[model samples]
Target: MPVAYNDDMDKRLIQLGAAVIDTEAHAIAALRTRINGNFAAACKYMLACEGRIVILGMGKSGHIGGKIAATLASTGTPAFFVHPGEASHGDLGMITEKDVVLALSNSGETEEICTILPLIKRLGVPLIALTGQPRSTLGKVADIHIDISVEKEACPLGLAPTASSTATLAMGDALAIALLESRGFTAEDFARSHPGGRLGRRLLLRISDIMHKGEEIPAIPENVLLSSALLEMTRKGLGMTAVVNAQNHAVGIFTDGDLRRALDQGIDVHITPIAKIMTANCKTLGPDLLAAEALQIMQRHRINALLVVDTEQRLIGALNMHDLLRAGVL
Candidate 1:
């Protein structure tokens, strides 16, 4: 009977996983030495492309190609992935003469991909090949060839594509980032591409877009009693209220946190003027400012809310950091 040991096997499995990571790191490091004029030529071809980039590969290479296509598409290069096997079916109709085809193959002899080479040539689409064997058929026929060869696979059997796939993926990332930099892709541009992500919220959200305006803004006259201001704070649900002068300009702000401090000091809520207990140095934001900028001001000042003011110091809106969180700008 096999005995079950008390020691956990999880640590050994973690170390095995680390080995694959270490192997891929070394493989990418070695690729630095192989960067020659070919890499530059590949970038130049992509930069000069008038249409979208169509990526093609087979097996594990196909999986990496799909991710590369996504990265390229998000980074300002219009790109899409086409499985070589599917291209041999009806997918070949998606390609056009203006597009550039980026093909990936470890041995540079994937039959499915090679079968479509003649058709691609007939369409006059330029080909960029990524392969381990430069002398293989795919490389010889390609308009531009990029060498992505690796010394060995991280897999113990030396058959599974481990380091090679990692290297290919890294090359694809390098290409996308290089194009992004060359095209001056800004954070705002990136936000446009990822409207559902946190980065988009940070870059694209504006104060006017998330602030409480008109009656939603809590405000009380400077002569109002503290008890009345507290009711305004409670009704507005912002935990605070602005004290405005007869001219409707914000003079100070009072919050629930302030009320607690006032009570601790034995102040009378009914007789005390709201302006007397209000914060005179309250921070404010502009309606046109980015929501991310508003968050920074609130965090730096250790405050939870801010009043929106115009150039004339008139309060137009009010918002708390919670508003930013609710708007997905946090």
Candidate 2:
């Protein structure tokens, strides 16, 4: 075809893509009206369960069920996915009396899912169903049924699972997050569940986890010459040094910025004491604070480093942006 014709076809495809997104979005929004006491009852049942949430599904619903299970596990509620087909084999042994079974079937009549209904019932487990047909076999058999019905699929043929899948996923997120809040799941709790992730590192890491302590801490006496402070800064490579008094409490800090200012004033580095040119009463934080919190302090003060101190104001450690970056807290 001609170049112009190809360009026009591309624009039409883009318009169709946008329309599909809009249709899916509207389908999810429509679920807000369907959120009744049934939703609350489902949450209560899951919360009261003593064992893990065993989610079962087939095909696309199976894919979404796995994701929902993962979300529930990472948040507060414990959950895991089980293939309905696999349950027919020996995998059904994984189910226990304490577990709550969550089965997903939009039509509520998948033969595989319905076949295992009797087995699930025999275990004396509570069954929560996410289905379009609440009056169907699976829904009718479930202890609690959540309606995920949608007007239509986004596909033009109305044969593919689009809007219904979106609605199911949104409902799953709603249930998981609502249960998470009710359980008082905190950021620290989430961090523990995801210790390998960046958010986990940020929330769980303390300033002491990344700060330089002991002999590695850069320091100098308040009476030291400006040249001696510069030598200490270079040796420590922290670009600054805490100036301590006889009691070892920090009185001030001399940084590279201070050195530039001192040079601008034409001061003699050999004769002038660091206390004369240092920035006194600098902002300091305790080692117990989170490294993420310390990053915020550095951002608010527009500085590159902060000294860690005790309640008595004695310098115990030091760190800069480089430390935070290396620790993956930045």
Candidate with maximal TM-score: 2
Look at candidate 2 and give me any clashing residue pairs. none
Any residue pairs clashing in model 1, and if so which?
none
Question: What is the number of residue pairs that collide in model 1?
Answer: 0
* Residue-level lDDT tens digits of model 2 in 98-136: 999999999999888998999999999999999999999
Cα error, candidate 1, residue 321 (Å) = 2.0
lDDT of 1 by residue, 206-321 (tens): 99999999999999999989999989988999999998888888899998789899999999989998878899868887899999999999889788999999988899999997
lDDT score of residue 101 within candidate 2: 94
Instruction: Quote model 2's TM-score.
Output: 0.96
Computed on alpha carbons, the lDDT of every model, listed in order, comes to 0.91, 0.93
Give the least accurate 10-residue stretch of model 1, judged by summed lDDT: 2-11
- Candidate 2 runs further than 4 Å off: 1-6
Full-model lDDT, candidate 2: 0.93
Q: Please report how far candidate 1 places residue 245 from its true position, in Å.
A: 2.1
